[model samples]
Target: MGLIITFLAAAFLIAGVVRGSFVNKRANEELPFPTPVSQEVEGSTDDRDVPYYDDDKEEDEVIETITPFIPTPTVSDSQTSDSSATNAYIYPNSTVLSTTANSIELSSTSDPGDITNWYKKLFEEKHFKARSFAQTNTNGHVLNKLAGAGGSLDLEVEIEKKPNEKITVIKVTY
Candidate 1:
């Protein structure tokens, strides 16, 4: 048993020496590196120290001033109501989809009932009478206000929330 162990150890040491010799030979070889190629310009001379520039003549000096631009601010609901002739009021935080002379469509992330309630309060504050209809996913209101010279202005508002949706659609007609 001792003789067999001695032979196995000698065989392993010889195999390691052979493998290390091959690795060392590979490591000593030089690696190839890339070199850059110089490009010559069409009008340049043989001198390499001076640079080439096309513009040789000096021109007159010109100074220009730059001004910062400012954008116009958007009108809020309260500010818009006082200036509009129809006294139309849009819900805050709602995105307007379309608008015409007599109608407006809007989209909101609020519930249908909340939008309906807001319109009801707005009508009451304007001293107008409104009739409301409500269902599980929809609400509607018809509002009336006295116009000048014995004429009446009618406004219709509808709010709908589709099933399993977080968005509500609003349609207002005047």
Candidate 2:
């Protein structure tokens, strides 16, 4: 009886291994799992709820369609029609990015320290009180004066030079 019981146990273990192998083989031959399918709901008129795909779309074209921001150069300081239009003098070698009624943005390749010193002297000569500050990557100045319109006007100039970059951004606000 002990021998018969031991043989039956061995036969059962062998049968389990064979069955498991068969199941694994079938799993590999077929899809391991069912894929999710999108279903449309009845009476849904909103097209946004549906998914649309264009098979011809290429990712390369999407990258090519992007436009870069290019700075637009303004008239040179000497070529400015009216000095009053811009109360503060623009850097001679700077490229103007944009201009508004009370502010101007520019890009330059000059050293930040040189630009700050130039502005300080220019403002002082014009009889405006100026204060300047400097740091590792940036320098700026603030000029104050009694406005002809009976109020005080302050001009702020900031220059930033990022590490490993050739372009310096300058912003002037009045």
Candidate 3:
């Protein structure tokens, strides 16, 4: 009687495990999956919700279509003209990144003295009010007073030579 009861219990446990796994297979197969809507689809929630983008547009056309990352450079209140730019000599490798109505910022690989020589002429030849002398072996600035329509335009050129840097940062600002 004990052997019969044990055998019946094992058979019932095996049958329950098999029935649970197989029961869901037919139900899952009968139901269809919810497909995702494509971006290219027209007149649905997917089409109206997505932002517009065209792949076939030309290079220039696409550039024109998109907004600029940076705002366009505007002339500041203390702006100077390009007259000083033409007068001053620049190194061949120097890059003039920006030029405003009143100021110019550039970087050069040439000697700082060479740049100072050009600014010196603005005082001597053109009669711009300039500093008497520059200190030796330091970041020296040549300040010149340029008489503007408003008043005296403070033109200061900083000759900064950093250690281990090949390029000298020269900023001529008024």
Taking all chains together, the TM-score of candidate 3 against the true structure is 0.39
Segments of candidate 1 deviating more than 4 angstroms: 1-87, 138-151
lDDT of 2 by residue, 1-174 (tens): 999999999999999999999999967763323334445657877644454454444333232255889999888865554646474568777998998767788888987777877767665766665454544532333222211111254667777776677888888776
Model 3 worst lDDT window (10 residues): 142-151
Top lDDT hit: 2
Write down the TM-score for model 2: 0.42
For candidate 3, give the lDDT of residue 21: 81
lDDT of 3: 0.59
lDDT by residue for model 1 (1-174), tens: 999999999999999999999999979966533333344666766655444443433435433569879998998764554326443557775888988777778889976667777877766666665455544522342222212111254666777666666778777776
Which portions of model 2 show Cα errors greater than 4 Å?
1-88, 130-134, 138-151
Clashes of 1: 0
Q: Estimate every model's Cα lDDT from 0 to 1.
A: 0.64, 0.65, 0.59
**TM-score for model 1?**
0.42
Residue 128 lDDT, candidate 2, scale 0-100: 65
Q: Quote each prediction's TM-score.
A: 0.42, 0.42, 0.39
lDDT sort, best first = 2, 1, 3
* Inter-residue clash pairs, candidate 3: 79-101, 79-102, 80-101, 80-102
